[model samples]
Target: MKKRSFADLFFLLFVVYIVLPVVATMLYAFAGKWNKTILPEGWTLKWLATLFQDTAFIQAFGRSVLLSGGAVIIALLAIVPAIFVIVLYFPKYEKWIQAAVVMVYSFPGVILAVGLIRVYSQFGVPMIVVVLGAYVIGILPYIYQGTRNSLRNVDARQLLDAAQLLGASKMQAFRKVLLPTVYPGLFAGALLSFSVLFGEFVLINLVVGSRFETVQIYLMKKLSTSGHIASAVVFIYIVLMGILTFIIAKLTKQAKGATNV
Candidate 1:
């Protein structure tokens, strides 16, 4: 009884700590005036309305979506197959792949941005391309883990061998048998990657700045203008992330179900 009471108290405190700020921010986004009050003085949607009406915000939102989606697509097309081949045919090289994934996080974003600028700017390469490449590499850990976990959950070797024995070529076996098994996990990873890159600021700011304003860049600009608008941006960002998280959870559950079957 005592332990249960303690657990309840702890859970309440945890919820308050994490949720209070978010709740306050949401209120402020629609609040007419919230100063010195536990409750908002009045509510209005002008902040959100203004945010949507801003062409810059809309463009930045689109750029963020495109950049994140493009990176995930590229990663899925390139990294997934490479990992699949390495896992099935060249198990010994998996260690090298793991090392590379770890290296994704080894360098700070600022350092990476500076190095990319030095190497690519000298050749007159487009800064957008450089940032896109970095975004792809930045998502390696999420994609690699999702793909690796999915592969591990099934007897990939046996499935591939069985498919081959049934007169399927290697490529056919992989495409028809293995890919479907891992699709849910890959999709989840892609969504996760998109969510991460959507909010990325430091690398994009240093590498491209206003040349390619993402949602985060736009949010930074809004902070000095009005607190309400900034709070609206945060609320919208939170909603976007929440939707992606819901999809990821659903996909993960479906993946587990498919693996079990």
Candidate 2:
């Protein structure tokens, strides 16, 4: 048998750290009645059925999807073009822009939520507007960093020259050449932000008010009212997120392959 290296050991530990909570949650979710006892009494699908039957859970799930989709679309539309412009035309300011984006990322979610609430209350903006704003601010840093890295890796000069050589317009070059290169990174950023946003509660709670319950908010409610139901909701949430992550991972992988070819 071969001996494991320190890196391998660390990697194994990291995997365990990631999976432990998920594994425990899955077990509890299946257990019909897991209490303060050492182990669950038995396993059943009752929790899953109860979870699906809840109308509020279904609505919250839809809202999360709508909010996340809107945020990602808006972020990409604004961020991608802006990053491209900065990298292509004003390379000198790349460092400064990157620094600013990093600083934006450092803004705590709760604090940002609080600020948004004050602004919204004064302006008479609806709760949905505030929720969308929070989503955009929260995910901007991820999108920015991903795009910046993608731009760094791609050769802007080559793209420009190719376009000119082929008699393609600037817009064509940007659309065809530049976009293809950076899409994988951008997709990755969007996916990461989506994963985080799906489960996000702090900002949404503060900005939209507790009356508007998202999936996470619903889970919080269940923890007190019905822990078994909460566990079930969490299990479903994990499955949903895992599926999303898997799709994004596949998309990113395909994007990388296309870029390579």
Model 2 segments beyond 4 Å from truth?
1-18, 35-39
- lDDT by residue (tens digit), candidate 2, 1-261: 135687788899999999988788888888876668777888898888988888998998888888888888898888678777887888898797778778777888788877777878887888787788767766877888778766666676687778879998888888888777777778888888888888888888777756677888888888999767888998988888888788778867766666563
In candidate 2, position 34 carries an lDDT of: 67
Q: What is the Å distance of residue 222 in model 2 from its true position?
A: 1.0
Which run of 10 residues does model 2 get worst, by summed lDDT? Answer: 252-261
Q: What lDDT is obtained when candidate 2 is compared to the true structure?
A: 0.80
Runs of candidate 1 with Cα error greater than 4 angstroms are 1-10
Write model 1 residue lDDT over 170-228, tens digit each, in one string.
99998999999988988998899999999999999999999999999999999999989
Deviation of model 1 at 66, angstroms:
0.9
Every candidate's lDDT: 0.94, 0.80
Per-residue error at 187 for model 1, in Å?
A: 0.5
